[model samples]
Target chain A: MKTRRSDRLVDMTNYLLTQPRKLVSLTQFAKRYDSAKSSISEDLSILKRTFQERGIGLLETLPGAAGGARFIPYMLPEEAQTFINELVDEVNDETRVLPGGYVFLSDLLGRPEILKRVGRLLATQYINEDIDAVMTAATKGVPVAQAVAQELNVPFVIVRNDSKITEGPTMSVNYLTGSSKRVEKMELSRRSLPTGSRVLVVDDFMKAGGTIKGMMSLVGEFEGTVVGAAVFAEGRVSERVVAKYTSLIHVDTLSSDGTGITVTPGNYETEVYENNNLND
Target chain B: MKTRRSDRLVDMTNYLLTQPRKLVSLTQFAKRYDSAKSSISEDLSILKRTFQERGIGLLETLPGAAGGARFIPYMLPEEAQTFINELVDEVNDETRVLPGGYVFLSDLLGRPEILKRVGRLLATQYINEDIDAVMTAATKGVPVAQAVAQELNVPFVIVRNDSKITEGPTMSVNYLTGSSKRVEKMELSRRSLPTGSRVLVVDDFMKAGGTIKGMMSLVGEFEGTVVGAAVFAEGRVSERVVAKYTSLIHVDTLSSDGTGITVTPGNYETEVYENNNLND
Candidate 1:
């Protein structure tokens, strides 16, 4: 259809990134630059191939009837750190979150860039695992799980405090929320996962292993395997997990005066490799 | 190096999908199949091309040092429905969600299969929209955003109500949330988007377009253009914008009647034609 060979990819890539949350297929991109679809496909082929060379961005395309390619500008941790640092500055509002010991990021969980970067960093570590699915509890954890699930190229399932719209009946377990004052019930579709599926459970916070345990019980009911468990933040009873996993940041609220947060290996690409023997 | 026969693209594709999150170098896949990197590359070339042709999956390959190939398995709506329907049936908590006038889908959002299917379906329509990036508010919306991001090969950004430790500092805004009782503050980072960028915003709910307005404002602050905005469910007070969009399901909630939901055009793929319109 159309063609622009000289520096088309970089410009096209930039053009696509400038318009996040939309799609621009091969034919359209071809027509935009005045190149043939085959030639444009060649350009996309180069762009997509280059993505895996570095741990950033993905070029996805659909096939047949309504098919075209779109570019996802995913940032590697090195790239992600810049934004994370900026976000932390906003979170420095110590007074508002002091009562809870941390800012309630439940609201922030809905933002896209932060979650995309964070999720990729986590997924960059676990891409080779026998990860059957990404699991999380309601509200906050969904974003994190979705990011990781995307990075891992697997499915993500959510657990709930109660039955709500969008689902039928569920299999649930009691969980003592870390910051909240109640024993919340977490539920999953009994038939969603098959028997002996390998699952990785994740959440935004884990003060006690209570929520983790509850999810573990839910997994147990389905005869699924809890291959790993993780959290974006950990507080108070950090060491209470029934097993070991990863975390991007560790919130050690244990030592009364020294209550602080330190990032952990769980959040890094190294942990994913080490745990899955990826480096081997 | 490794390589398969001319038509063994499917096997190669599956082998890569089963591997998940790992970056498989050209040498690795080449060696596994006993083919030259060039030959493997050709196969991958075919795999990526044909995989999309079959509407089965995507192949993203990293070039140069520390690079490899990754396959993400996804399906269009027609294929995903039956599989997801079974899972939906298992989640048969019809009673609990009636109060919210919705099904309790907080958990299904986390399931990998459901997310994979839904994300792919929604992404098909926008795949050729020349989208720059994929945007979604946090929590439950993350997975949906991730699936779309992966399918489109773009970055997904998450906004927040309040910044967390993971995020250092942030750009803040007070937007009206869904149909909640009050207006909630939403936050994003200044550098998360490029000025004059085109962004697509996706979310799980759209009660009043309050938070969406805030996100639109956030896009404005970045000098970015909103290419489109969509939600999985309809909001309380709906207003049409330049790119106002809905999803597979629409939620209509009245003060007296409460909530009503229906499926929409978010499923079927958008038709894109080959611009064979050439010289006279």
Candidate 2:
């Protein structure tokens, strides 16, 4: 089946975008497009250059008998900073501050465009990590986990506060809710995360890092290692139980009256920027 | 700044894909690529032909002063059938049968690849409908709603079984659970969904579709209309509460001994295929 080069580029680009971080060998592209290996190689060079020039992602190509190309999703530091600033602005509204100092974020977290950008930014932080699966607590964390998991091309396991009959068998852990100090149970399907897997834990918000700590311990239950943890936003607390985690925003202050709320960009600069390979 | 056709195609494909269902005027492309309007038109023609030929989607081109192109996501009936069959097979195992005849599907729902494909398949059913938002119950339905909402380029609203303090104000409704015949409550945020919006409700599974019905009525509370409802799978029930909906698979039987299990394709063929504009 002969294919035009222009048509091939569009099809190939669509394929690569859908398959982030997955390696595709030249032979596979050659056979799919019914083009010569050399033509396929040339096309890849164009793709690699275009991807890098446009800051879409990095298209890493290997040359040899077992050579292939893989798409690693990345965001430029400037773009990430701009997006984070926009997020900080979006949540800085006084009306968003609910009772008990919780900020209303489901509206932002539920948007696909915002989730896609957040997913890419968070995924960039763990691009090279051996992430076998993404772990998150139920309800709020589902969207965040799904977004990052899709970018990394890995499955996500939902930790539910209450076990459902549909899950068959589950393992539960009791942890103290950071600010509330109430012991709550979180559970995961025993079959969701296999033993020895490397997991990335994420959530929509962190209040004293109780939920993130619960997820890490749950990962330990399955004998899986916690590669890293991240949250969309972190509210200021007296003492943080979980250390070494990435967050996109910090809710600095929230008066009991719901006014005087202040927001700032989280530690993404030092965590994501310095660790990112875009400059390299 | 001049741009090559090959590079432009790569960038344009990525942009169109990320902005599904969004109309992009030729002028915008021309300015972004620093190319002539005629060249941008030519590039879109190639993209349209390639996207259609590859069954990626439909690139609808409008001609004139207000002319532009929009990508409508679609899946070929053949592909949908193939995918639905795989889903049926994946869940047909006897071991999947849990106590109370529940089929364990968290592992499948947690998978990003499966979720993406399922999202596209479900979204294909309502490509031509005016969908303002996607709605689903908390926990299982979040991923499904996210997937379809992303394809439709719309935000999803999650209906929770219990109201959270962070949601500010919410409206709740009581519905009877189909199989169990127990009355349960479902709620949605007062502000997440605007009034008079068209909503598409989706879920991971359905027995009597009590949950879907609950969501539809909740939409009514917001003065929103439910344009459609869909599920990833439907299990056998003496009577289903929801009359009109699309599903990918039907689990006809699960013996009490967990030995005799049967699964088949749902009404998606008649619903999705007949309604699909792929041939056009």
Candidate 3:
């Protein structure tokens, strides 16, 4: 189809956005739009500059016969801070406190916009890890994992607490629940991950980190390496078994009367910002 | 931040893509990009044309003092057919058949790209519904519902088969399992949905339609209206309890001996394509 440069720019931007972190050859674009390679190159330069200025992401151009452009979506430090601060305020609501000292986060996690922001923030931290897949437990963590996987353009595997007949052959691991301190089993289908894959673990909330630890063990069983773990929120527990993880927000305190709650920004904000600057 | 039209177009495209089916005023974009309203309008015009030509979606501009634009992401008929045809071919593998005639689909459902395509096709069916939220049963259906909900820029609520304390106050209901013909219970947190919501139920697979029917009843209990229902794939059964629903693919024959399988594009492809053409 014949198209103007303006039209090509718009289409190219949308195309790159949908397939973040994936390289697309200019020849492919040239063939699809029936445009000259020079024109496609010009369009990429425009898109790359715009993406960087607007904090949308970095558009890296690979220069060679096998070269193309790749879109790596990331959040600027200011944008990440704004998102986390807003999330902190949202989670500070007293109504979100439950009977067992747990914060009722289903409503927040269910919102696509919030999940996307949180996903971007977490995915930004590990964007350069060459992550092959994202893994999370069923129920609460699916959206978070899905969001991260979407941004990274990878598959997400859910570890279920119960074995379903439909999953076929499965690998199960028992781990202690961080809060409950009870040994619980988590299972992932054997076919979900190939051996030696690098996987990132994501969850909505973390306290004792037992679930994350369990996922680490399961990853080991699949012969996959754990790139890292991240969460939307983490409670202020004196001890955590799973270390080396990033969280967007940290719940400092939750009142028993459900009248007050305190949350603060997580430690990863500064780390992410500093790391991003160094990369640039 | 001051930005050129090239930068604004890239950012605006990203913004509109992230929040599909939601209206954004020109003033908002102008303010965000530090651009003039006329400039923003011109940028959107370029985006709208490109989006349409590329089968990305529809960009409906509302003109007036209070008007702006709404991005409705949809698949063109040919694109939809291509996606469904490819999916059918993928799911027709004999190894997917399980002992109880179930098909293993977690791998496909877990892929972000496939989920995004499935979400777009399903969301296109209800683009005009003004759906308030998407709902699904826990486990296998969460990703599908989340995908559809993300496409619609809405929240998705998961109805869990087992009620957790973290969900707070929940309403539970019992429904007959289609395959096993056993009575099973599903529960949803009361806070998940506000009263009088219009919910679209989504699931990964459907057989007897019992689960979809249960979700419909659950929506009714929440004082919400069932806008419609959608599924990734459905098993061929002579009888279905739910009459009104759409499935992208139909599993015609799952050989008990695990020798052969027949899968076909769903009945909604033509309908979706026709409706999409009408809207365009």
Candidate 4:
């Protein structure tokens, strides 16, 4: 399993980029390279130097018991936003994406790498903002919350569709959802959120603003305030409330046919990149 | 924020060891230490060499637009596995953590630093398992997936409860959700997953295995295989598959009385510490 330094780093980076937050041990790398442990060490040094010189990514090493190395991708906020906006434009299919006069974002969330980028794009915006925790409804919105939470170094909370024994006592709310005439129930962990917390709301879709409003109520119950809100896709249903917000992609239905769908991100990437406040 | 180098090295090693898959930037460390970037780099080099000398960990760095550094905590497969089993033991009851039947993982997830360690703990086990991707049902699982995916450097795919228009055509599978009772639908994009892919299934809870099985079915439709399955907590409901799996913590029902829950983590740390196999 002997390979050149260039070969090892290229293959290692490719292997690492494919997996999102997982780790590989030096022993494994050493085995894969069929080289001595000392040689593997040398290769890793070259890889790290290569990374710093390029400014494209970051590599992490874990030490002591239960330790290894992992790689995390860090894009220049502007560069990332550009990619996201382009992706949105490229995905513009007036017929398939925009339906019933709304932009659709389901396709974007389904792609893992793309979702990470989108999440990062949104996170880059709020990192400097005074948001305390990220919040989203259970099920679809979790990925976005996860992505944002990672960057902000904060815990993200989820509102479950129903209360479970595991969740203990919960605060409940009812709200109008999308086209549904009836109000649906949303629950939040009474103990999970603290009072006076600054919350950043995230979700997969925005239909009637019922769920977000419902979460707002839950936040209120906890004495928390909504600092900001964002969604993967926002439907053309009436805007729920006037608040600071952004969208990774937008959905719209322009024609009579339900097949009409167009997806474009709001000015999210541009706004964040222009701020250029990436200094930690 | 001033700390001794020895303590910092140990702490840093422990911190990075848990998230073997994500990269950390020098800027971030420098900020934490109020130290110059150059000084931080020097410290990292010293730490990196120590790890290489001891055959303990690997420090990987990304280059170009994705530049940063990551500390990967790795253990041989046997050891990595043992560590997961040992985690079940650290469930603290006297820590006032119990609120109802749940072990109250909220505290763990709420702390970004702790979450990073937990992510590293899980990532070490799945490294070389030939997993093409990481899969988790939405909500709490998203963060867990994100944490591990950051370490693994692989794409993490999240399944959603409801479909949004932006995803275009989607394929859904009906699964029994114990929480909701009635059959519910979880969806993925028709194009996101390929046929016969090897995927690692992860989630926050394991109840009846309905969602997991359904996810397996969805993967099968694309000819994908489940390389491994993991859970943050194994709760009241029994698992659907008797096959081998990994879990950070195990939640057992002490009694039907008020949803009595007993928390335990298997020998996760010990497993990681003991195995010396594949020592290159």
Best by lDDT: 2
Candidate 1 chain B: 10-residue stretch with minimal lDDT: B271-280
lDDT of 4 by residue, B1-280 (tens): 6654433443455345434556778777766667666666656666666555433556776543334567665544454455444444544453323444445565455545555555666766654455677788766676677666666656677777777554556778887765446788888776566667788788877766677777877787677888767777766554354255566676775443434446666334333334421112
- Tens-digit per-residue lDDT, B1-280, candidate 3: 6777776777788889888988899889878988778888888888888899889999999876466899997778888888899999999888888776778999999999999898888878886777899999888899999888989999999998897978999988899987668999999999889989999998999998999999999999999899888899988887899987888998866446655678998878755665443222
lDDT value, residue B252 of candidate 3: 66
TM-score, first chain, each model: 0.65, 0.96, 0.95, 0.65
Give per-model TM-scores.
0.53, 0.97, 0.95, 0.66
B142 in model 1: Cα distance from truth in Å?
1.4
lDDT of candidate 1 over B1-280, digit per residue (tens): 2322422343454345434334678877666666667766666666666556445556677776456777654555556455435543444333324345554455456555566666665654554355666667755677777667655555667787756554435677776654564768877655455567777788776655676778888887777777667665553354433245544544343335434443333322222112211101
Compared with the true structure, what per-residue lDDT tens digits does model 1 show for residues A163-238? 6454555677776665454768778866456667788888887776678788888888878888777787655553
Error of 2 at B110 (Å): 1.3
Worst 10 residues of 3 chain A by lDDT: A271-280
Each candidate: chain B TM-score: 0.65, 0.96, 0.94, 0.64
Best by TM-score: 2
Q: How far is candidate 4 from the true structure (C-alpha RMSD, Å)?
A: 11.2
Off by over 4 Å in 3: A64-66, A253-259, A274-280, B1-3, B64-66, B253-259, B274-280
Clashes of each: 94, 0, 0, 97
**Which candidate comes out best when scored by DockQ?**
2
Q: TM-score: which is higher, 1 or 3?
A: 3
For candidate 3, the lDDT comes to: 0.86
**lDDT string, candidate 4, A166-278, tens digits:** 56567888766755657788888776787799998888777666777778877888888887778776666555552546666666665466665556666466455565544
Off by over 4 Å in 4: A1-77, A93-107, A110-120, A178-182, A237-240, A261-265, A269-280, B1-91, B94-107, B160-188, B207-210, B236-240, B259-261, B267-280
lDDT of 2 at B67: 80
